[model samples]
Target: MPHSPDDFAPYAHTSLPRLLTTAHLLSGAPGDHREPTELVRRTLVRVCARWRRIPRDDVDFYVRRFLVKEYLRGSRGRARRAKAQRAVLVLLHWEGLREAEIAQLLGWSAGAVRSRARRGLAVHGDDAEHLRGLFAKAATGLVPLDVQLDAVEQRGRALRRRRRGAVAAVCALLLVPGIVFGGNRFMTGGSTDGSGGGAADVAQSPTRIVAPGERVDAVPGAQVWLTTDGKHWSTPEAPNQFLGLTDASAEDTYRNKYQDKYKDGYGSGRKVSVESGKPTVSVQPDPLNNTSYFLSGLYRGLSADPARVEVTVDDHRITGTVLTLAGSPGWGVWYARAPLSPEELKASSVDGGPTVTVYDAAGKAVARGGAAE
Candidate 1:
């Protein structure tokens, strides 16, 4: 299974623009050409040298990891203050990856990823549109692909010669804890499903929300806006816990332990199929009080375009707040709060216990999610 420059060229062409934008952002200077360009070039060289040995399925992710490390190793001054925050935001929004996916990439726990990401979001979440604009602008400034391709081949050969084909050391440097996303690579502006296409059509499911409750709306209803306001992240019931949600795909949502598998209408650690177009929900219990819960997740794949997210707990339904970046194709974060009596709380599972549903603008139920035996 040997690979040559010709074999690797196509991938490099498709990935270079994104790799350049990531480098520019991580450098804390989206408009600057010096740091980001060099970072991408060097990382590309490393990938090119190991092209034959690196698994084909992971080439994109491997490139991203190398870019992050190279950035961290070289970061300094003002750029260091919010490095984690910036990195987390980039991966979540720009890359469309879930918290767990990012955790794997960064060698951190999912909880750690959430905590730092909340902090970062508190600072720049409201400016999502502006940030995206910056990324798009940066993509235009990348070094010419042909010039970089030449550099990659030449530098890759030199690196291989110096190391004498010792890939073990290189592999060790690249090793980081997390689940491998088999046959997936970094894709910009589309779904990362293995089908090599856009997001799948939303499918119907048995999941349902209680009727005759407050209708879902687009206005922000959460206690605190993680993307805007900087305060109110913590409640008396759950000190310092972020009460906002980030967008996660159906797969990422169900994979979480708290929401995985259902038994007798509850998430009970059994396998379940989370169909496309059906919304996926995760609940975070308030640590100090057993009465309140925070619900959040994604609704991007529905057959009908999603207009709102509705949550039903103990027959009480509430309109969930939605966060969508400008220019995005109807995909963003949906969150709601459920305060239940201790008895009611104890009766439900922590993560997938509530009934969450998504509706189109015409108020049709486009997709459904939550525990159902």
Candidate 2:
């Protein structure tokens, strides 16, 4: 497959800033120890090498998608999985790709893609402020524009040498009749199961959370939040674990969502508050019953024990208590479990899992999170 110089040149030169912006945000910093230019140079090299296979229209979009997707995956055995859901959302709403296009790119259903994007936006709050912060920072990095350009050019030349060496090796291998044809070309196309083009941990699983409990508005430690969809229900599982509800559609969506943000039910740990450490919030399927996701993570800092925690699903506030497994506080994990009413599911999906307020033993509003910050 061959591409004209005209096609390769524009995609290489024009797409660099967009690619750099995405790379900067996802990688926290672009390129290597001595040079950050490698990120841009290698991406351009890969896009050019695979130019023939990639469709021409929206070529820049495809390249940007590939750059972020592959860069998030990194090169070693352990891939970077943090904030993957946000990255995918950035590709969808931020990058302006439609639901159908995202589905085509990631091998997901249009409905499912829409569903996940909605959920992602709900958690992270889709807004221009985040983007403003992103590009604002991108402007400052990579000083001395001439030197940066020179570094990119130098890396591009080095990449060409490596690619040529690879081609020669392939040619030599072809000379032997019995050798298997496993082409390890630097170029690759998108994968259907989302392993190739989407941002996710390839081996990620779904996380589970309990619905808001009785006697309490939201459990003292509401680990995860679920929209008010009644297609789900609760059931018992382990001594201290929550395997309460299950939904097949959510199961599929969770698999597609990637990365386990709230696998362990929220507030399962000893630390009730965090001064420095950012704990993980995953949504995983219940291993015991293949049903619901448990608590995700701390949405706000709370007192030693909030007698009651309030959760807002769809805009309606639901009060839940710190439910102890089998009425034993020794279970040590308090959770808020609320399943949305049918009428509310749609709205909850758009606005789920945000804490309304936490109450002390005397039932007073604990001012924190949201606009308070």
Candidate 3:
């Protein structure tokens, strides 16, 4: 049995195998099980740690539902591997290992192993028959299981080599046009040299000017700042900057230095009001889990009064509620609570970074954040 949240807290790190086994049992297979288990475990830990703030009922539902959705989405790729698995099944059976032993070795339950074997036998009847004969011969001291396994491995390698060659041929074919176009451009010196010489160069040069205070062209959506002296640079700030508390203890030191530099209503005077009449929404994104989401903002807005606010991270709307806090004018901060699927977190936009967007109840844009390397 799985431990309760409190009992499991200390053992969270060590219970990974149990979590994996639970996920496998629930999903009927361990397909992509390792990653999902880790994600769920981390989400549970965070949720349990903040149990006082999160609604227990919602947390329970969210955890299970999120896992199911992610598992289903992940299984699409596994469907393609069914053919390869059929071949593996024949090879495994020919090694004289019983079905139970195969189940244990593969980390699958007995029922799943039996189901896979039956389905595999149906799909590869001839292969199974041939393999069975080979196994019988081996049992009678006529051949060896290791030799059969070796032959299977060799055939698999040959298939892979053929696939690789085909892919190379396709890539070469696609590169032909690009190669010709580049060659033509290089020979004609058409915009190839930085110095403009062609008739078109004069037309383009005037449009591109390097000027003082001009922003440099950076990767799209990147945040860059410039200082006049080129000595120290800071992160680009919005018109009304709200400095993040990197180290809460250092707040006083920063306030002392810059507090008097700006006007009386400069820093803390710009208030982000969470009106009682307006609904409050919060969002949080967990780096550990691939999930980023929002919560309670919509419901709060509806219950209190009709209002519009948009939350955004890097200009993308969060999909679900991850965290919520309570207080007047919403003195709480929400985070992306649902774990991100591994693939979602790993995926990058054309600019090669994660883009996040948040919107308020009125579908207006609020916050945007992104990371790139």
Candidate 4:
């Protein structure tokens, strides 16, 4: 039986913003307008098709799981850490889900959830609350409700038509003698990955942008690859390393709204500096690769010439990769994976984190900040 458009409109109207926000965070590109909207639209179309059949108490959970699966589908080429970090962060912070619930949703053990959540929170403390505020502020200018509802209806209708056509084709084939269809092998929407949503498809890669007539030089034996656009990149070792990029805008907006919040000595422990073209640094553990941590941040407001960013992890200095996109995106992405042992991670938890320094082409240190203990 088919569900009516009227039946789903009310729920969609109320839930769309949060759903959109979740999708934005999970997609690892909150600043990119199209990816988040497209993700929510696809997930909602799926929900609208089966709205009546879903249990009322479980609708929110079901929709979140569905949205996660949809994100994983297109994220086949991403590294395991990239995928796991996003899932754990959004579920723990944004959705207010516990470790056990997130375990069931992602097919991981409760211990795994606890371990990752603890490590993630160690670095991204209070980020979710600030991010939610910025997203809510941005949602004030979204399109009218009727237009959004109509779009969902049209997509739902198209989906049903295709499903009916597939059924008819299957039935027509069934008429042949001695023919049998087995398992979900004949099903059109079966999981592309063999793990049944536990992993991603091996055939597809994350979407990369390459401008025509532009020459791109490949970095020899590089673990990370950046597109010519500079706005996007891929980390094969820990795909979720890039997830930190999603929080950039939210952090910036929060600083603007509370420009004088930390000027007094009351909250001296936390460092909140306004953007004055100086480099910022964020370091967090890679859940999938336990021995390594991701170090990344924006390098805007620096000299237009090539700049060198370096990080001193307990006196071991490493040169970082800095990406400045074409058309002057104001800020560019800079990152490096610092090797850390269990002993070091434990010690760093007590001491401060790494020290990051940015130097221009002239070898002069321009900006410096870190989790100074």
Return the top candidate by TM-score.
1
lDDT of 4 by residue, 95-198 (tens): 78987567655645566787877776666564757655654555555543222778887887788778889999988887554235443334434332222332
Candidate 3, residue 247: how far the Cα is off, in Å: 3.7
Better of 1 and 3 by lDDT: 1
State each model's CA lDDT, in order: 0.54, 0.41, 0.34, 0.54
Model 2 per-residue lDDT tens digits across residues 260-367:
433222212122233333221122222222322233222223333444444454444444333332322211123334554323332333333333344444444443
- Model 3 has an lDDT value of 0.34
Candidate 1's C-alpha lDDT? 0.54
lDDT of 4: 0.54
**Clash totals for all models, in order?**
1, 46, 32, 2
Model 4 residue runs over 4 Å out of place are 1-5, 77-80, 125-147, 178-373
* Candidate 1: 10-residue stretch with minimal lDDT: 210-219
TM-score result, candidate 4: 0.41
Write down the TM-score for model 2: 0.36
Model 4 lDDT, residue 229, Cα? 21
Per-residue lDDT of candidate 1, residues 190-212 (tens digit) = 32111233222222122223111
Cα misplacement distance, residue 20 of candidate 3 (Å): 38
Candidate 2: where are CA atoms >4 Å away? Answer: 6-11, 27-38, 51-55, 75-79, 106-116, 125-154, 157-161, 164-168, 171-175, 178-373
Candidate with the larger TM-score of 1 and 3: 1
lDDT of model 2 at position 171: 89
Residue-pair clashes, model 1: 1
